[model samples]
Target: MSFINKMLPNVSLIWPDVWQATLETLYMTIVSAIIAGILGLALGVWLVVTDQNGITPHPVTYNILDKLVNIFRSIPFVILLTVIYPLTKAIVGTSIGNTAALVPLVVGTIPFYARQVQTALVQVDPGVIEAAQAMGASNVDIIFRVYLREGLPDLIRVSVLTLISLIGLTAMAGAVGAGGLGNLAVSIGYQRYQSDVTIVAMLIILVMVFLVQGIGDWLTRRTTHV
Candidate 1:
């Protein structure tokens, strides 16, 4: 407290609120990421495997999914938040709290991350896939044991980008009463003109962002043998 107060004299009054807000931010990110990761991975793999020249090659399904991904990707997240308010409320019983915010956050991230995942899967070597096929591997087996396994390093990189992106969006969602560090920063800090609080919140967010990036980079390096 002494050190923090020395650096930012008002830290004493808001430290407790800052800590609570940090937890809310963590809660929002973790829950949102988990939901997005699962749904995005499935949609992404399906998009890749069902394309005209892909492993399963169903042109119709691929085209439909491709269009949907494109459409969702086009909608800016701030607009999407309000646009989906009814459904978000129905699902989460509110449209402005952290949990309600998850609906839009997850929906907003899914298509983007799906595209990232698809791109990563598409980077798998053609020869490796051909060899897998030559060994009579089924499409499911190829998807799991080949594309996902071989492209993991790239996938990790994309996941890091998505997670960082979500952190920013969470800050924006704070405007709608989605309580988090973002809410603390914008509502209490900025709106209330407490520059010190805003600075502290931003610094905390920066540290979190750096940690996520460093871990992702480390994991990518560890997973890559070449």
Candidate 2:
């Protein structure tokens, strides 16, 4: 008790903020990740499948989706926070809180992760697909049972990267009044010159990053059956 009390500044005031901020951060990261992961994976598979040499090539569809993905991925995230405020407001009823912050977070990461998924799927050995085809595997079987399974480890890696990047974006989102550790550190700590508050928030963010990284690595290892 004494040691912890000495380490933390104004324990009564700062403690609750730390816990709430941490929850807000995790809430946004996890929910956005779940939504992004599902959509990104589907969009990615579509990209790979619609290529000229793909199993179900449709050049027009591919070209359109490809362009859309490129456009969203090109937008700088901070600018995106405001550029899409009207859409965010429509979706969440307000564009300035943690819940609303998820709008841009999910949108930004979906394309980013979609491209990562595309690259991972593209790297799967061509010979493996040929083998599946030779065995009369349907397109759905090839996609779900083979490509996705073979790409699991890489998918896990990119998922972690996406989450970490999203964490940073959440901090940026804080600039718009979206509350989290970033908001706490910026609005209260840095603005007030409370270095201790800043330090604690930074430490908490670092620990969370490390924890996410550690879990991702473990999952990747487990998925790599060899």
Clashes of each: 0, 0
**What lDDT tens digits, residue by residue, belong to model 1 across residues 65-171?**
99999999999988999899999989988887888999999999999999999999998997999999999999889999999999999999999999999998888
Question: What lDDT does model 1 reach?
Answer: 0.91
lDDT of candidate 2 over 1-226, digit per residue (tens): 7777777655346787789988998888888889988999899999989988778999999999999999999999988998999999999999988999999999999999999998888878888899999999999999998889988998889889988898888877875699998898888888888877888878888888999999999999999878
Each prediction's RMSD over C-alphas, in Å, is 1.1, 1.4
Q: After superposition, how far is residue 101 of candidate 2 from its true place, in Å?
A: 0.7
Among the numbered candidates, top TM-score falls to 1
TM-score of 1: 0.97
| TM-scores of all predicted structures | 0.97, 0.95
Q: What lDDT would candidate 2 get against the real structure?
A: 0.88
The runs of at least 3 residues in candidate 1 whose Cα sits more than 4 Å from the true structure, single-residue gaps closed, are 1-3
- Measured by lDDT, the strongest candidate is 1
